[model samples]
Target: MGLWDKIKDGLTTDKGEVAEDAQSQADNAAAKAKEAQDKADAAKKDAGQPDAPAAPAPPAPEAPEAPQARPADEHKPKRKPHREYTVVSGDTLSEIGARFGVDWHDIARINDIPNPDLIYPGQVFKIPNK
Candidate 1:
């Protein structure tokens, strides 16, 4: 069978059928993978190419450095994050913005609401963090 047909058959098969012989299935999968790898190596050898090197392990990610101390008076506004807020009855963009310490225009811009004054209940908006 073609690869796609095999994939479709696998997907359409009943779960009970798959669970019947799990160990044998796993062994078959490993054998198939090893056979495919062997075929690829043989093809490369036939083309007069040297055997490919084993893949190297990925480098570990560096740990983040600690933040330096800042002056108490240095009050630079950090870039605020956003949180999703669902609109409720009697809620307006201005009131929502006021409650969240964000500008009404910013709320409208972020959410791409066509009409700033036409928000309905259950509509979700990304409210910027204070």
Candidate 2:
């Protein structure tokens, strides 16, 4: 039976019967949809086209290895001191300061810049340590 006709008939039945009927119809609809999808997949295979994309393959297992011991005296290399930065085209004091992890005002003060907004290309500015 058609969906609307089934629903109309359900409205005239007992509430419990109506709910059961609706559940049955929904289950049938789901079954039909799954069947249609299976047929489509088969048709695509017959036509030499790829089926719907599949779930990704699981990642490969990792190899278990013993951790290597390090010498106690070994330490991370120290960061080199930042001294100067030559301004390039489109280089701003704020951007240069950000690259060196310092404030633009500090860079301008250290470089004795007269106008903070008047920096030009090839002008070198001193970068202060953070």
lDDT of the candidates, in the order given:
0.88, 0.85
Name the best candidate (by TM-score): 1
Shift of residue 52 alpha carbon in model 2, Å: 99
TM-scores for the candidates:
0.39, 0.37
Q: How does residue 46 of candidate 1 score in lDDT?
A: 100
Give the per-residue lDDT of model 1 (tens digit) for 1-130: 8999999987897878768778778999999987888887899999999876545478899989999999886797656488899999999999999998999999999899889989999999999776
Whole-structure CA lDDT of model 1: 0.88
Provide the lDDT at 111 for model 1.
91
Task: Give candidate 2 misplaced runs (Cα > 4 Å).
Answer: 1-82
TM-score: model 1 vs. ground truth: 0.39
Q: Residue 37 error for model 2, in Å?
A: 99
